[model samples]
Target: MQNKAIDFKRQVNIKLADTKLQDALSRLQTRFVEGRSAVISEIHHLEDTRTAAAAIRDCVLNDLDSWLQKFEQQAIAHGAIVHWAETATDANRIVTEIAAQHNVLTAVKSKSMVSEECGLNDALEHAGIKVMETDLGEYILQLAHEAPSHIVAPVVHKNKEEISDLFAEKHQMSRKTGIAELCLEAREILRPAFLNADMGISGANFLIAETGSVLIVTNEGNGRLVTTLPRVHVAITGIEKVVPTLEDVTTLLRLLPRSATGQSITNYVSVLTGNKDAKAHDGPEHFHIILLDNGRSSLIGGEMQEMLRCIRCGACMNHCPVYQNIGGHAYGWVYPGPMGSILTPLLSGLKSSPDLPNASTFCGACAAVCPVKIPLPDLLRNLRTRQMALGLKSRQEVLMLKVWGWLTLHPRIYALATKIGVRILAMMGGERHLLHTLPGATGWTDGRDFPAPSGKTFREMYRKKSTK
Candidate 1:
């Protein structure tokens, strides 16, 4: 939320130098990437499903006002309260005020990225309310006082041994090496919080405007407990999460779990229509939904509107080469990877996160796997162009671009320049066939060696082949 993305490169270097991080990140490809590929391949019409899902999201965005109004009317009709928040501050204030009004002392929270975006935990704590993260990944982060590194896998950046140490230190329990043992230990500690909490806070996977229900999909049972066991329940999410109907929610559900965790469907999918009725056996007495704008309204009819279609499935980041090398924290905010590169700049301001757009390799791995088909590489490139227009780039970069542009305008000079440049690079490479870091230049070379040119222009090679 704070946007330390200004330290993007520094954070990247720190994460790269960390062997433990590298070891942990190595599994991301196998776990999320390959798993998604295998699971999605099972669908005979995955592309058609994706296109339809995208269309549903686009339909919502095209007439967001009418849909939101319909949603509000339907939700109130079902006896639920809906609140609009214009900014992060407004959102936080609304939640804390709700807690205060309910006389809530202890609150339990399920994993919600929008809450993180609004810095809700700190705000609630400052308001003198105790908060507990019920999701295992989020609970671990809460214990260690660390932020989530991945959207679905919040604690992906940490290893089991580190988590074991954290639990032992924080929970004052004996160290457990087995994953199951550790999970049970966490559950043991969190059970009391679930029973004692006066209010529950959660993130919505999809908001169905038709039935006025809040839907959440989870592998663990925490989501249900957090929303039902407490007397009061509050669901906070971006306005982009709304869909037109239950069928729309169902269409997106077909892709969310597969794209996120490679599951057929999450173990628990709960649809909360409203609070407890007079005849209902058990449920929260008061239910509220906070729709957060926080800079999303500006993208409705703009070049960046497609970004609003994201389902937070994280398929794009799972395949991102840059994120593979450096984990999400380097993006320096709640969202990370390809989507973070676009959304962080758009929401937080392009000036605050100048480096995020350029963090991509333009390889299109992200776009290929995107369930919604957001053209991520093109968006990142557009951000870079905006950087140029705003004069945010260094003079050296601008000068280099200008020189490169001028050279391409003169064919003979450009040809001669390439021929001479290749020979110089060849001489520098000598027998190694690779160029080491040039003096005073450790940009790319700092990480790895650059291959030297072949010392022959493409034109010369083509002419020789033609003669042959």
Candidate 2:
């Protein structure tokens, strides 16, 4: 996938102007955010659960190499093959090779985020293999040729009416206005794909090092089907997903579904250990797990290591003000919202995605709701610091910051400048008292007006209070 993250502001502009996209994103907050808030109280001790979850993830990050090795040894012992990938391209190539080796005709996917990061669909198509997305949101995106807007809810940028139209056109069937009718149409169309697909691909929620099992939770039963029925199954996930034990997985599961979809438990929780046994007649014949680094290893023992704790729950984005307006596509990558804002630049290159670090309001809402207690705001600030240190900021912005720093050093002059600037702003406002446009800030006022200062500066107010 060509990265549009480089065009952050441009994409944001387009997403903001799109009222339909706005309406679609609003539903994300209503359904996910409100639902999460309502269900969190059900946890015996929400904070304690979050703490335990964070500790388990941090424990893995502390010794990720050992756990991954343990997982590999255990998985292989159980008849599953483990592959390591240093880059997204490497992971894609590995998957393609496996598909070719098996003479796979059709590949059915179960919404793997790492696959999106690896551009596996494009790579498979390039290799002359047919790829089918089994997950409903991913299937919709596969038909639309659009990237996902959110991590958990990939098709949040789309509404039912638009999906209905797409389904009718893509399925080449008569339009179905009702949601149930459209779902049935998709099911009928996809059932054949499930039965005929030679290979299955999915993303793992947690890789239990103790049992060497690939655990994934889904409301839709496609995860189970994609792993089964097909002769070959491939599970791809970031190396950070590995945990020490199933008990740790059990702890994380308490937070994942609740934070992601507000469900106390997902309808289907599949723990796939390996291929079918000689005595058994079910499960995939060949099971492969791809552990993708893709820049994750570099963050180990660093300022950004906390980022690896992410479970793709997407609570950060659901409550994000920026995401609520611009949606995920504006982030210009598969990962979106606060997590994407940090991950895109970290996993991809900062030079390619310079605007992502600054795409936040520093609201800390993302950090507050993060189930694993990732300090997202602090990490975002770290990226901004790195961005500035690397000369990623424009000359004008750098100069402005320098000037502001100098003014801060001289309080009297800074106070005088602010006082005069406010008076000038007030004069410009006239009777309307709203500044439609201001100096040095362009396009910002295009959408809304800024209120002119109505009183003295904070310093002046403080001095007056002291005198009183």
Candidate 3:
């Protein structure tokens, strides 16, 4: 993962400077914004649903242990083999063992973020299994040998032309310019992989404890096919995905799609109960469920426990200004955006991902749009504090912040520094009241001009007013 982080940062720096990537990201971001706005505008009870969803998630988190046990019992009764994986290694071993038992040479998979979290694809491929991604976005990324750039829209960073070029190169297909044509081409190429796969892997959207069912919501029909067509089906989910009942799952269903893609409901919503019975026409013969702990259990009683409430809706990322500017690869993980800022450090370890939590501007846009009400900015700050305690912050930044803190504590020094700074900026800007370039202000001035501070400090005016 550490190596992946470094590689991701390098890729993002290259991708950010590419004009094609910028244009693609801009168009994609705009579509999401407009679509979500349209949905919110039409839905009169959006906020109420968000509140109700948040409450449901909160209740599940509060009683996670009980719910997990109940879910396991129900799933076993429904003929699903339930496996508890307390670590990534455990999770990988469980999946690989299942695949080996079935002599699975090829596996067809839907987009499961939990699988990404566990590095399941690479693990299986390493064990000599062929893994094929069925999602169109995921397929594009797989061909490019890249991780997902966004949670919902995995290849949001790629333009159609880029995809056309990739397909022509990778699959020897003709250059297709139309979006629908490209999708059709991918579908045709993946259809064979699906029919030949010995195992199917998918991520659960929500796990219903009452009935021990795995719920998956997707726009493409591939998710349904992947789970039902193969001889063996495996569902990978995080511990946090468990809910008390189908009713609780309904509350999340109302908010997730609107926050995610501005749709009232995704095109396909599948509820799977264990394996197919003898009378069932079509379904997997064997069913397995891997519940991943992966450090999430530790967070249950900690300060950042609220983060477990995230539904992976990608709303926080969609609305975040930082994510809008830099995109997901900049955060360098399976998760990105505001939710990623908090989750990456907790799951990946704070010392390695110090830059992630500090990447936010704390503008609170993420929290405002989050349907589950995760306090992203606050959690990021908390992670930053923890990082500092661990001495993971750079020396220069620490010193700078300490000096700033000291000056702010001393009113006289702060006032004097502000006056001097204002006068210097005013002199530099002259009548324009703006600076295009300033020493020690390169980061701020690189893209946008900085407005010069007023000649007089607010403290001076306030002092005069008080005296009068």
Task: Compute the lDDT of residue 299 as modeled in candidate 1.
Answer: 92
Residue 222: error of model 1 in Å? 0.3
lDDT of 2 by residue, 361-437 (tens): 99999999999999999999999999899999999999999999999999989999999987888888879888889
User: Relative to the unseen true structure, what is the C-alpha lDDT of residue 49 in candidate 3, on a scale of 0 to 100?
Assistant: 75
Which pairs clash inside model 3? Answer: none
**Superior by lDDT: candidate 2 or candidate 3:** 2
Off by over 4 Å in 1: 439-441
lDDT of each: 0.92, 0.91, 0.87
What is candidate 3's local distance difference test score? 0.87
lDDT of 1 by residue, 190-249 (tens): 999999999999999989999889999988899999998999999999998889988888
Clashing pairs counted in every model: 0, 0, 0
